[model samples]
Target: MIRRPVLLRAARPVALTLLVLFGTGTGTIDLWAQPVQKPLTKQAQTELDTIGAELRANARKREQKHQSARQIAEEMERLRTQMIDIARTQGASEKRAAIYRSRLETLTLLEADMTRRLGTLRNKQSRLLSALQIYSRNPPPTIFVSTRKANDAVIAAIILKEITPELKKRAAVLSEQNRDLIRVRREAALQNEALFISESDVSEQQKQLETLMADRAALEDQLLREADAIEARNLELEARQRTLLGLPSPLRAPQGRALDLQLPVVGEKAGSYGESIDGQTNRGLRLKTAPGAQVRSPGNGRVEYAGPLEGYGQVVILDVGGDYRIVMTGLGRVYVDPNRTVAKGEPLGRTPNLTDKPTIFYMELRKGENPVNPASGFDLTKL
Candidate 1:
């Protein structure tokens, strides 16, 4: 009887644990293993079982919905990656188009330059032909023709008097040896024609050579322009890359840095700085003066661009320190060699005639890449 009580006490705790485990996922197995007993009302047990079955179904549905949502999210992520790749491809195409457009512009300029040079060559050839014709027609005026019959007869008589009677009688036999001067002159005219043909052929050949040279020169200029554009593009791309990589911008010289052109005799302001009288915007400040007037360098540095440039006539570009450049234009002739270093107020060359309208000295100053108007930069005290 005591053993029975002890066993019942242990069985009570085991029963509670089985009830807790059944309430979780082991409910079906527990129900099958346990003996059927009418401890609670049959209606209440049936209702509890039905609610557990409904709960299990709802959990399974929720799991399915969660899995579907995860798959959709993964697909959306993949599409977003593809879109980014497409955008990058579009950007690359745009850059290529821009480069091609620049190249086309450069090619157009080259063609125009070549056309101008060819026209110049043709004009030179025409002038040469005219000069050759004038030379051939006015042959030195030194060859004199005598038309005095007395002189001719006297010359013939002298010859007869000097000769013996037998020789004089043989004169008729020698008469057949006399040559025709008209025939000689005709041959000379033919020679002149041959020379003209030769000279014309040479001139044409020279013109052809000049055309070839101009073509090559234009090609070179185009190449240089293209190279510069490419370099600029590369620089821009690099700058963008640096920005993307979170780098600081490169330092450059400040704009409108004051420069000194150590000239001693600063000429007067022959003309006020403004647009041309025609209202066209002037590229630089023009100081009107006579030809052969001394031009002073505006700044001290090595000369960069020193030659005959279009529109500006003769120009000398000086490279001042700190990325400053000074352009002195409208020169009559360049007296200094390129790459020569000069001080401010240094004599450059004589001022050239500005198409006979005015003898002007055009000056401009640049700091770094920005242009500072000469009117604003230079001291106009000496003008």
Candidate 2:
């Protein structure tokens, strides 16, 4: 006997509850939704579509005939490869993470709001249902068709005309919310499974990735000394020039020229390069980042500068090869010290965990002595 998936097992009760809530199963219309913060690039969107398609394809596989042990092993290898590809590609991976984060955030806000609204709706529904049950004791009156007299028909028509539109609108909103909740819950379940995989019975592929992450996070004593020396030298050079523009490009250039980069952090675009603010022109893109969000290196690079400034919070600069440098600011903490070789997508630090408002993160990509439009510096993909 085949055991149905947990989702399948609980579907009926979920459906029934939703039906009772709205008097019809529902929620797809964004009745009271706020605008979502969209930061994905074209490539990132494409990558997401690909991932979703693949996940769906994988789901379809279960409906087919069961496989042998050999076939299962082969499938596992294929899945491992797929996971690695998704994880390493910062654009798709980070975008997905951002989507998940934002979605959960939005869902939280909506759920809170909906909890109150749903309670009211449920109360209204209860009254309506009670009246419905009482009326069911007799033949329930339809607008005009079921009325016994002309005056009764006119009264019923008048009442329905006043109530029908508002009731229908509320019903539609409830239906859409129900659907959205179901979808969100399903995704949350998948994340729980992802979390479980990390905790126990870890896969070899995941272990290898974890090892790399741990290694990147750990800095040796020697690396720390080198980073400090480099940071000091860069500061001295900047002082001599009396300028902070493109400070990392001239010194300690990386060997290989990276052809691409992911955004250093996920955020809503708060400011952009060349935009004038309070009479001063902005030199880099600024983002309103998620609270306590992990900042990642945009590309494979050496940490040229990672410390704090007077007004700005913690900062990190990366020499991302071929004299191309990335300067990031507004981190709450710097994870990588100076002079350490950091891989693309490696965790650099985190934004301040302030909840009142989002912390602003600033990033600039420069070559030689000038800041270039971030898009011109390299392929800037979504993170």
Candidate 3:
């Protein structure tokens, strides 16, 4: 009797049933005719499940490493900016510049190191891929076959031989499938190796970037520390110059020689000197006007500064004659250029949304370089 190829397909699962059938002959064959489901063993299923989980984890790790590399590149950019700033700011001082140079050198070395490590990993990855390709395409060794005579027993043997060829074909398919699996495993290994090397290099880059950042921070701190003392010294020098010029220590209200300082626009004069507005002393009267009010020159002067000055955004400093300088801050845009002369009451700029109510320009007076409150020179009582 001819046995179906399906019988061989179920060989492993039907091992126990086949053995009992072979022992009882005809009676057991009838029992074996009924279909019975048999699942893979727990250990075999667990092994397959583990491979899938491993593949998923490897993919996840690969993604994480790529993200880490991106982060490292960003941090490297930040460090490069800091390096540029340091080179520009501290390059004059040999000691400070040397510090910056050292940091730059360190970062450069780190970059080169990372490049070398990445190259090595890439080569390793390529080799692994090549090995995997060869393993996949090259087939496994085939099983040997035996050729003999045919008779009553030979009929049974021939039937077995015919089915055996089908078994060999099935096994070949399985062998190819296993080879494909091995290729996948090798590829995953290569990915893992690359990720490991890349991550290590990225880690080193992060450290170097952090170090450069700290150096930049130290340089900034040094600059800030010297800035206050320099500013104080400048103020002292201005004060001494004022004393030498025979100007009063503090110009008293309505005491200075009168100069025709033109008004910007007719707005309600609100406050005076030593008075408080917005929790700060009102150095000049707050003129309450509509939002985006035009401000004009107090007197003809040459524009000295026409940009942001500390605590005053978009300011203009004009050198009015007789050592007088008028500073108008909180401007939206400047209408005049530096060194450009203007007549009395010429438009300087406009103030927009200065305070909760309508905007007012923050005006101050500086004689030469000494900032004298505008109230000291103007007659505020008249307003």
Judged by lDDT, which candidate is best?
Answer: 2
Off by over 4 Å in 3: 1-257, 278-280, 353-357, 373-382
Better of 1 and 2 by lDDT: 2
Worst 10 residues of 2 by lDDT: 1-10
Question: lDDT scores for all predictions?
Answer: 0.50, 0.58, 0.53
Candidate 3 local lDDT, 85-114, one digit each (tens): 644544344444455455555545655565
Query: Using TM-score as the measure, what is the rank order of every candidate, best first?
Result: 2, 3, 1
Better of 1 and 3 by TM-score: 3
TM-score on alpha carbons, each prediction: 0.31, 0.35, 0.32
Candidate 2 residue lDDT tens string, 115-219? 677778878967875774564465435554443565665675587578768877888887887777677667766755544444333355566655554453342
Residue runs of model 2 more than 4 Å from their true location after superposition? 1-258, 378-383
Q: State model 1's lDDT.
A: 0.50
**After TM-score superposition, what is the CA distance of residue 205 in candidate 2 from its true location, in Å?**
45
Q: Which stretches of candidate 1 lie over 4 Å from their true place?
A: 1-257, 262-277, 353-358, 375-377
Ten-residue stretch with the least lDDT total in model 3: 1-10
